[model samples]
Target: MKKSIIVSTLILSSSLTFAFDLSAIAKNVVENVTKEQTTTQETSTSNLSDTTVSNGLKEALKTGVNYAVTQLGSNNGYLNNTAVKIPLPDNLAKAETLIRSIGGDKMADNLINSMNTAASKAAPKTAEVFVEAIDKMTLTDAQAILSGGNDAATNYFKANTSDSLKKLITPIIQETMKENQVASYYDTANNLYKSNVKGLVDNSGVMGLAKNFGVDSFIPGSSDESLDEYITTKAIDGLFTMIGQKEAAIRANPLEQTSSILKEVFGK
Candidate 1:
C-alpha cells in the first residue's frame, strides 16, 4: 500500500512539472513575439522620422515639377490644352468681334495664336523657378505639407514662389511675345479699330457713346499693360494647376512615389 502511495505521488509530481514546463514555453514564445513586434515597429518609425519625411516631401515635389514641366513644355502643350488655352483678354474680346466684323478675323486669330505660343514658350522656364522654390522648402514646411490637405504643397509653392516666378517668367514671356509678333499684331488690330470705329463713336453725338458701343473701351490707350503681362500671368497659373494635380496624385497613390525614401515615408 505504501509503494502504491509513493508511485501515485511521483506520477502527480511529474504531471505538475510537465504542466509548468508547458506554461513557461508558452510565456517565452509570447514574450519573444512581442519583442520582435516592438523592434519592427520602432525600426519603421525611425525610418520615417522628420528628416526622412522632409526629404520624401521634397522628392515628391521635385517629381511633380518635372512631370508638370515635361507635360507642359511639349509641342501644343498650352495651345492644345483647352483648360490652359490662352484666350483673348476680356477687354480685347469686344475688339476681336469688331475686328472680325470688319473683315479682320485673320488678325484677331493671329493675336490669339501668338499669345498661346508665348505662353508655351515661357512655360519651360517655370521649372527653374520651381526648383528654386523646392530648394527653399524648410523641414517645418514639409511636415505641414504632408499633414495638410492634398493641395498643401501646391499652395506652399504658390505663396512662396509667386513673386520670384513673376520676376523670372516675365522677361521670358516678354521675349517670347516679341519673337511671336504678339505686340505687332496687337498694334495692328488697335490701329484698325481706331481708324474704322474710333471716329464713328466720337462723332455719334451721344455722351459716353464709346462705352455704349464697346469700341474704344476695348482698345487700351498708351501706358496700359501689354498682352505679354496677361500671357505671363496665365502661364504661371497653368503651371501651378498642373503641379497641383501632380501633388494630389502623389498624395492619393503611394505607388507614385519615385524614390525609396518616398516609398518608406509616404507608404505609412
Candidate 2:
C-alpha cells in the first residue's frame, strides 16, 4: 500500500509541472504581442500628429497675414492710426508752419491732407508683398515660427521682406501723392515757406543765411520732394507695424482648428 501511494504522488507532481509550463508559455506570448501592438500604435499616432501640426501652422500664418493686410487696406487705415500715421517729419514741419503763417494755410493743409490720403490709398498694396514673403518661407521656417514667440513670425517675415516691400511701396506712395494733388500742395508750401524763412537771408550774410536755411529744413521745401519721401517712409513703417500686430495676435490667440490637419499638428 505504501509503495502504491509513492508512485501516485510522483505522477501528480509530473502533471503539475507540465500545467505550469503551459501557463508560462501562454503569458509570454500575450506579453510579446501586447508590446508589439503598443509600439506600432504609438509610432502611428506620432506620425499623424507631426503631419497635422505642420499643416496647421502653415494655415495659421497665412490667415494671420491676410487679416493684417485687410485691416490695413481699409479707409483711414494709415491716416487714422497714430502708431503708424505718416505725419510730416521735422524737416517738413518748419516749411508747413511758415507757409500757413503767411496766408498759404489752405495749400499747407492740402499738402498735409494729401500726404495722408496717398498713404491710405497705398496701404492696401502691402498685402501682396506680405503674401509673397509667406510663399518664400520654408517648412523649417514655419516650424520655428510656430513655436517661436508672439512676434517671432512677423519679425521673420519682415527680415525677409522689408527691403522688397519698401522698394515696391516707395514708388506706389510717390505715384499716389502725385496723382492725388498732394504733390502740388507740397511744392507750393515748400516754395512759399523757403522765401519767407531763407530768401531774406540769402543777401543779408552768407553765415546767417546758411544758419537760417538749416533751421528751415524742417519746413516744406519750395518743393514736395522731402514731404513725398517722408510720407512714403511713414506709410511703409505703418504697414509693417500693422502686419506685426496681426501676426502677434495669431501667435497668442489662434482661432479654432478649421481642419483635421491643423488639429493633428497643433494638438502638441
Candidate 3:
C-alpha cells in the first residue's frame, strides 16, 4: 500500500508541473502575437499619413500652377493686369515719367505693352515646367511645405523651378520679343528719353555720384540680353506672385480649395 501511495503522489506532481509549463507557453505565444500586431498597426498608420500628405501637396501645387498659367496666358493677360504688367526697369522710371511729360507717352507705352505681351506669350509654356517640378517633389519636401508659413508652397517652387524656368522661358521669350519688335520699341524709348534727359539725371546728384565713382555700369541698358533677362525675370516673378496668391488664399479661405485633395490637404 505504501509503495502504491508513493507512486500515485509522484504521478500527480509530474502532471501538475507539465500543466504549469503548458500554461506558460500558451501565455507567451498570445503576448508575442499581440505585440507584433500592435507594431504592424503603428507602422502602417505612419506610412499612410506620409502618403496622404504627399499626394495632397502635389495636387495643391498642380491646382495653383494651372490656374496661374491659365490666367496669365490669356489675351492682354500681363498688359492689362497692373499687378503683373511688365514695366520698364526701375532705372527707366524717371526717364519714362519725363518722357510722358514731354509728349513721348505713346513711345513709352508701346515699349511697355510689347514687353508685357512677350511675357504673356511665353507664360503658357511654363505650365509644364511647374508640373514637372511638382511631379518630382519628394515626401520630405512636401512635409516641409505643409508645416511652413503661408508662402511655403511658393517658396518650394521658387527654389526648385526658378533656374529651369529661366532656361526654358528664355528662348520662347526671345522669340516672342522679336515677333513683337521689342528691340525697336526699346531703342525708341531709350533714345527719346535720353535726349529729353540730357544729363538732367544729375539733378538728384545720384547720377553724378555714379559717374564720379566710374559706376556707369550701374545704369540699365536696352541690349538684347538685358531686354531678354529683364522680361524673363519679370515673367517668373509674376508667375510666383500668382502662385503665392493662390496658396495664401487656399490656406486662409476654405472657398479657394477647389479640389477634394486640396480641401483635405489645406484643411489640415
Candidate 4:
C-alpha cells in the first residue's frame, strides 16, 4: 500500500508540472506574437510617398486639433474635464483652502467656477492659431514625427508655437475673464476672507515673518501670477495636452485615423 501511494504522488507532481509548463509556454508564445506584430507595424510605414505622408500628418493634426478645440470651447468644457480644468493660482489656492475652512464655500466656489468659465471661453481662439501652424508644417517635420515617438508632433508644436499661442491666448483670456466676471468673483471672495480672522493673517507681522523665513513661497498671496497670465498659461497647456493625447491615440490604433490619407499612410 505504501509503494502504491508513492507512485501516485509522483504521477500527480509530474502532471501538475506539465500543466504549469504549458501555461508558461502559452505566455511566451503570446509575447512573441505581440512583438512580431509591433515590428511589422513599424516597418509598414517605411514605403509611403513624401506627399502621402505629409498630407496624412496634416489630416491627423487637423482632426485632433479641431476635436480638442471644440471640446474645450464648449460651455463648461474646462469646468467638466478635471484632467484639464483650470484651478486657482498656487498662492490663491492656499487662500481658497483657508476660505473653505472658515465657511466661505460659496465665494470660493464662485471664483473657481469663473476661472474655468473664462478658460472655456478663451479656448476657441486657439483653433485659428493651430490651423496656421498645421498648414506651415514642413515635410521634413512630418517624416521625423512619423519615425519618432508618439508625442513628437506635440513636442514640435510646443517648441515652435508656444510663444505665439501665449501671445494670442493672453488677450482672449483677459477678455473672457471680464465677460465671465472672474475678477468680480475674486473681489467678492477676497472681501469675505477679509471679514474672517484668516484675512488678518495677511496683514499681520506673521506674513512678514513667513516671508523672511522662506515660508512665503508656501504662503497665500505670495505668488506674482496675475489672474490673466495664469489663465492664459493654463489654457494653452490644456489645449496642447489634449492634442498630445489625440496624437498618441491615432498613432497607437490605426482605427483612430479617420481619413483615407491617414489610413493609407499609417497602414491597416
Better of 2 and 3 by TM-score: 3
User: For residues 138-199, could you state the per-residue lDDT of candidate 3 as single tens digits?
Assistant: 99999898779878888888899999999988998788777666465665656655665545
* Candidates 2 and 4 compared by lDDT, better number: 4
Alpha-carbon runs more than 4 Å astray in model 2? 1-51, 94-105, 180-228, 254-268
**Model 3 spans > 4 angstroms off:** 1-48, 180-182, 185-225
* lDDT, model 2: 0.67
**Candidate 1 residue lDDT tens string, 26-138:** 99999999999999977886767687888888888888888778877788787788877888776677557677888978777777777777777777778888888888889
Q: Work out how many backbone clashes candidate 3 has.
A: 0
Please write out the lDDT profile of model 2 over residues 53-72, one tens digit for every residue: 55666676666666656666
Question: What lDDT does candidate 3 reach at residue 62?
Answer: 81
lDDT for each candidate structure: 0.78, 0.67, 0.80, 0.79
> For candidate 4, lDDT tens digit of each residue in 114-222?
7788788778888888888888989998889878887787888898778888888888777767765547555555555556745577668787788798656555543
The TM-score measured for candidate 4 stands at 0.72
RMSD (CA, Å), each prediction: 11.0, 13.7, 14.4, 7.0
Comparing candidate 1 with candidate 4, which one achieves the higher lDDT?
Answer: 4
* Candidate 4 least-lDDT 10 residues: 215-224
In candidate 1, how many Å is residue 188 off? 8.2
Write the candidate numbers in order of decreasing lDDT: 3, 4, 1, 2
Candidate 3 lands at a TM-score of 0.68
